[model samples]
Structure formats: structure tokens, C-alpha cells
Target: MSNADEYIRKLSFNFTLSYQMPLLTIGAYQNPIAVAMPAAPLAAAAPALAPGQGDHVFGDVIGTIETALQSIFGGGAGWQTRMQKYNSTLASLWTALTALDLGHGALPPIVNRAGMAEPDEHSHMFGGYSHRFQWQLCELVATGFVAGPTGANIEVRVIGGATKAWRKGVMARFDDLIGHLVDSTALAFYITSPTVIRHAAALVRHSAISLTAAVAYTTGHNGPGKLRVNTVLAQYASLRIAFESILLRLENEGGTRAYNAVDDSWS
Candidate 1:
């Protein structure tokens, strides 16, 4: 698997373990060290408080653990930034493609200048000499034209000679459409994931912050218990919504025609 996949898997494991740990266990780690020792007389009567009081419960621990995981596996801020860059690129490409006027008309004829004297004949015509106009004819593939062995704009055909063999020209047309879609979708995937990765990081950070605050409160002499934990958990509801929003956006984008066009099974 890829590094990102492995990292995410590890993070998932961490999250699972964090939630599995009992609140009392976590509280025991730092609480006993931080909390003031009760007098001998009251010590016997005072209830033992967990590390984050009740606030660092199963769910709370999971949140903090996820954050730590993100920090370690995601290369801290770099992953987030990378995702942002890709997401922006996808958005920009989408904008450009959508705004462009694919002028509706016949496909321009291919002109031969092999024996021509005056090459200026087709110079002023549509899709003349400029590589720029040629690109418009196949912008979808144009968007994703990668370098080949000879440094030419080349595309790979999964089924060789299928383009010419197909009498209906369906295969070639589909190939062109699919190539364009794939490039566009790739751009979208790159750009959109950053938002999710960043949001996930933020969620983890928020949880950690909440846990730290809870630990502080619990270590205090007059700290409350369950009430404080509930309050902190409630604070994360909105963040959860934000995370969901990113996931939803990804789902929506994945279902788009642009995405389908670029997929391996586009035909």
C-alpha cells in the first residue's frame, strides 16, 4: 500500500485504541501526578478522579489520539498544505473548463502542408497552425497530455488498434472523452483531499486541546467531573459537522460526470 494509506491505517488503529482505553486509566497517568494530595483524613473519603476527570472519556481520548496520529503520519503541516494546493488546482481547472466556450461547430479539417508552397493558406483558418487551437479539439486529453519517450503529447490505449478498428469511431471518441475526464478528476482529487486532511487534523487538535483543558480542571482541587466532560464534548459537535461537510463534498465530486469520464471503465 501507499505511504498515505499506511499512515491512515495506523491512525485508524490509534483512534480505535484511544477509544478502547478507559477514562479512569488515562486519568490515572497524569491525574495522580498533577492533583494535590488530599489530607490523610479526607484522602480515604475523596473519590479517585480520572486523568481528564470524566472529560477524557473514551470518545475524548479517541479525538486526541487521532490528532497525535495526524501530526505524526501527515508530516505535521506539510500534508495539509499539499492537499490545499491540489484542491486549489482542481478548482482552478474546473473553473477554466466550465468557463471555456467549446464553440459548437464541425471539427476542423486536417490540412497537409507536406508539398505546400504558401503555408500561409491555412494560417488564418480555425485550428490552423497553433498547437493552442488543436488542443481545443481535444481539450479533455489536452488537459492531461503527458510526455512520451519521444517527448510528444501521447496517450495510452488500453486496447491497441481499437480506435481504428472500430468502424463507428465510438472507441476513439470514448477514449478522448475518458482521457479528459480522468485528468480533470485527478486534479479534483488532489485539490479536495487537503480540506479533509486539514479538517481531520483540526478535529484531532481540538480534541487534544479539550483534553488538556480538562486535565487542568481535573487536577485542580475544586474541579467538577461529569458536567465538565459533557460540556467539552458538546463543543465538538460543530467541528464534526465541518468534517462531514468535507466528506460530503468528496462524495458529490466523485459522482460527477467529470469524474466518471476519467475513470478506468469510462467506456
Candidate 2:
């Protein structure tokens, strides 16, 4: 097969495998979910920022409290960096696709080939661009991830192009394409399934409940009905507790271990 054709085929294959494998193996097979624990209320650091005598304190205490809060939550820099990496990868893919002229086979490489070096950046050029053959029209369907500016927003601005052109019949073309691309990229980049923030919250809850149940069952902390509830709680805690029994025996003996559908907090 021609190099451009080969590249597209490979990309498509990669996309499908990345997106489908997780759903089939993890998302489908995994049961129960992890729920996030609510943040504990901050104890009174000192008093208020307002001034006071021997008992009262200055604004410094307030500042300290603020600092602590920032330290706890503001260090998501790693997540941002990983997102940038994903974006950069998408950008590279965009360059390749454009260079290959995937939109149409007949069209020559978008970038001129004259002299200087390289084999179509992947064998996209043919006979030094003297001849061009048009192939099937390539249309990328984007997922919301693109519009949401996921992966450094590369999926949208870099890959989808500054101006997206779709068939006239399509009304929600841009929105639809963005959604597909984002979902696909999230899967491809993180090896995880696409998920809404709500899913994460739900998973966190489920996991906690599952875990608590498991602990209760082992300890015999409740009656039959109460035992059933504890089992559910135990399953929720599976993300932390590795023992499968802790998750299973706790909640109907069928606890689930679900990965966050959203891109990993790291990637």
C-alpha cells in the first residue's frame, strides 16, 4: 500500500485499538467504582484575620492557612505537563496527516518536496511530487475533548485545523467532530476510556462504599442487612485496598474495580 494510505490505516488501527481495548477489557469487565472522599473541613487555623489581643491573632495566620490550601491543591503541574505531551503528540500526528495529504489521494503533499532531504516524512511523497493520485476523502470526527482543549488543545487547533469544513447536511458538524477527536485522543493518549467529571465522582463514591463493606464483613461489624451495606462500602475502597476479597465479599461478593474513565490524573 502507498505510504500515505499506510499511515492513515495505521493511525486508524491505533485509534480503534486504543479506544476499544479499554472498554472491552477494563471498562466492561471492571465492576464497582472508586469514590473520592470529601475534603475535611479546615480547622480554625488561628482565629480570623482581624486583629486581637493576647488571644487574637494577626493576618499572618490567615496567610499560613491559605498557603496550606494552595500546597494541597495547586500542585497539579504534573497533570498539565502530561497533557502537554499528549498535545504535542497530536500535533506531530497532525503534521504527518497534512503532509500526507490524507484529505485526498490525488493532491500532492501539502508541503513541497524539492531537494534537501527525508522520505515524505514517512514515504508520503511519490516520484518527487511529479505525479499525484487522489484517494478516499478523509474526515475526522472529533469528540468534545477537542473543543474542551484537551491534550493542550492540540486535538482541536492543531489536528482539526483552524477552520473545519464538513458536509452541508451536517448541522452539528464541529461539535460532533470535536467530541469524537477528544474521546479518541483521550483513549489513545492515556490508555483510558473517555469519562465525564461526574463519572469520576461516582466512581469515587462506589469505591469507598465497596471498601467499607469489605472491612465490615471481615470484622463482622454488622447484622445480615448491615453486612450487605458494608460489603458495598468495601468495594468502593478497592482502589486503595488491593485484596479482591475486601471488595467482593463485602458487597454482594461481586465488587467492581473501575478505572477513572477520564484521562488518568497524571496523563
Best by TM-score: 1
Strongest candidate by lDDT:
1
Q: Model 1 over residues 1-267: C-alpha lDDT tens digits?
A: 554334334433332233221111212211111122212121122222212211112122222222322321122454334223324543343333323212111311111111212211111111111222112211111011223334553222111111222212322332222122111111122222312211111111111122334334334423223343334334434433343233233234431121011222211
Give the clash count for each candidate: 6, 51
Could you tell me the lDDT of residue 188 within candidate 1? Answer: 22
lDDT per prediction? 0.24, 0.21
lDDT of 2 at 38: 18
User: Could you tell me how far off, in angstroms, the CA of residue 33 lies in candidate 2 after the best superposition?
Assistant: 18
lDDT (Cα) of model 2: 0.21
Q: Give TM per candidate.
A: 0.22, 0.15
Model 1 local distance difference test score: 0.24
Q: Which residue pairs come into collision in candidate 1?
A: 27-50, 27-51, 86-191, 87-191, 140-180, 182-262
